[model samples]
Target: MPRPTIEDVAARAGVSRALVSLVLRGSPKVSAGRRAAVLRAAEELGYSPHLMARSLASRTSHVLGVMVSDLHNPFWAEVVDGLDAGARSAGFELVINTGGRSPARERQALTGLLSFRPAGVALLGPVLPASAFTGASAHTPVVLVSRSSRVSTVDTVNDDGRAGSAMAVDHLVSLGHREIAHIDGGNGSQSAPRRTGYVTAMRRHGLTPRVVRGEYTEAAGAAAVRALLSPAPPTAVLAANDLNAVGAISALEEAGLSVPGDVSVVGYDNTWLAALRHVSLTTIDQPRAEMGRLAAEALVHRVRGERVTPARHLLPPRLVVRATTAAPRAMSGL
Candidate 1:
């Protein structure tokens, strides 16, 4: 059987093949009614896209594929919003996928995206190795978010994790917290920088630093808190991220402890969950959406042949004080 083509759909919809092409590419030039007709005709005809031929003809791929490490973390949603908006404004469409935060799975997801021959790819908080990213960049323009790269071929946008972690420690210190513990973002993107920053800040403050290993999930955070019940728990904890921090809260409550009274907590990313009226988690805001927007802009610059030197953007993070942080009870008198 002959496969349906764009011409078939165009004929069925009573529109030009060019109009069908515009509709298939999600071009803004197509009228609403015509777009609906073209889509409906294509659906009825089961016409699959000729992405390869279209890509080769124009030498302008309108598709941008994005791979997010984890969708469970609300932070990625905001970042994706910025990327989507930026891509659309610059005349590109985005399709996104997630690996749920596994390096192997991330590599697979990245490979699948690259196979589509997108104009470029945006990797948000990927856990894949540097070599993997570099290899992919060689095939297509690659912009990495929340990961650093020495290769000038790959552009990167990241919040300075070291500074952000240090800022969290400083906030705790200012609140008179000396026995603070850190829930490390184990093996996650930029986790090492944060862990190192925590250690450095503790040494600078003349205080002992303790680390709890956990992944970037609420369950891991809760488990870490449960494991900290012995050996005299620290007065407070700085969690890896907002999702993890919320899990820590649940665990702390389960352990018969009141937050900000018995154990203060701080989270990272400052995602929407942290800002909720109920969560009100003190956290480090990483300008996540801005990072995504900047990443898109950087990738577009390459696609447009504007910048040859890789764009490396390092944005600062800020500490947001919320209901979760308070002066240590021991020093309320001071």
Candidate 2:
């Protein structure tokens, strides 16, 4: 039997073939309702996209696929800004999708991107398995940001999480914060390194390491802070990221504590949100935009066969002091 086609899907969905084509190509111009109808029809007919055949016929591809882990995080927006600028300068267009921080969804996003057979793909902070990276690299060049892979074909770009965490700890210690706590990025990418740094730095400073479980979200940070409220709250907190720090501050205020007076907080990721006048979060600054640019450059190089060795770019992170941090009240004699 002959396989299903776009025309068949269009007829089934009562839409024009162009509309069906746009839906298959994942165009945002298509209405959500129409797109859903087209997708439903295609699924019913077992229709599949043949992007590989189209690529072969065209003999050139200008599309670069991008998969982002969490669209809600402001950090990703800055990174994508750099990626977009880099890709555009290289005469390529980017098609972006988000995995919503789910490993399963990330795998699906990866598979969907691969179906397009783009020249290359960039995954931003993905939590997908190693097998997924290796499998994807078999068909196209893959570059990762905020994640690591042992696959020979994959390139990676990441900030020095361990050093960044240590910097936060050092800053807190310098402020005479002996009772310090860390809200860790539990199970998140690069969490282990950050946790290790926090522990090592606390031990070096002769302070007991108090690590609270948290994720890469504000809610997690708030919850972690709430958990720390039991016995005696720490004088300072090192959050997993900017969002988490903001959340921790909010929770502290709700608990009738003054920021930097009752508790000083340090955050990782100097995202724009952290620098706002109202937020003015003291944080570890990761070069988010630069990492994105590097990832894109590496992927484009691999696509053009310009370099063979895997690119591993690990950028340094520095501390950005702001209004959110100060010495403990005991040290200040306040």
lDDT of 1 by residue, 218-281 (tens): 9999999988878777889999999999999999999988898888999999999999999999
Give lDDT for model 2: 0.90
Q: Which ten residues in a row have the lowest lDDT in candidate 2?
A: 51-60
Model 1 regions lying over 4 Å from their true place: 1-5, 9-53
Per-residue lDDT of model 2, residues 184-214, tens digit only: 9887888888999999999999889999989
Q: Give TM-scores for every candidate, taking all chains together and pairing residue i with residue i.
A: 0.88, 0.84
> Cα RMSD (Å) between model 1 and the true structure?
4.0
Count of clashes, each model: 0, 0
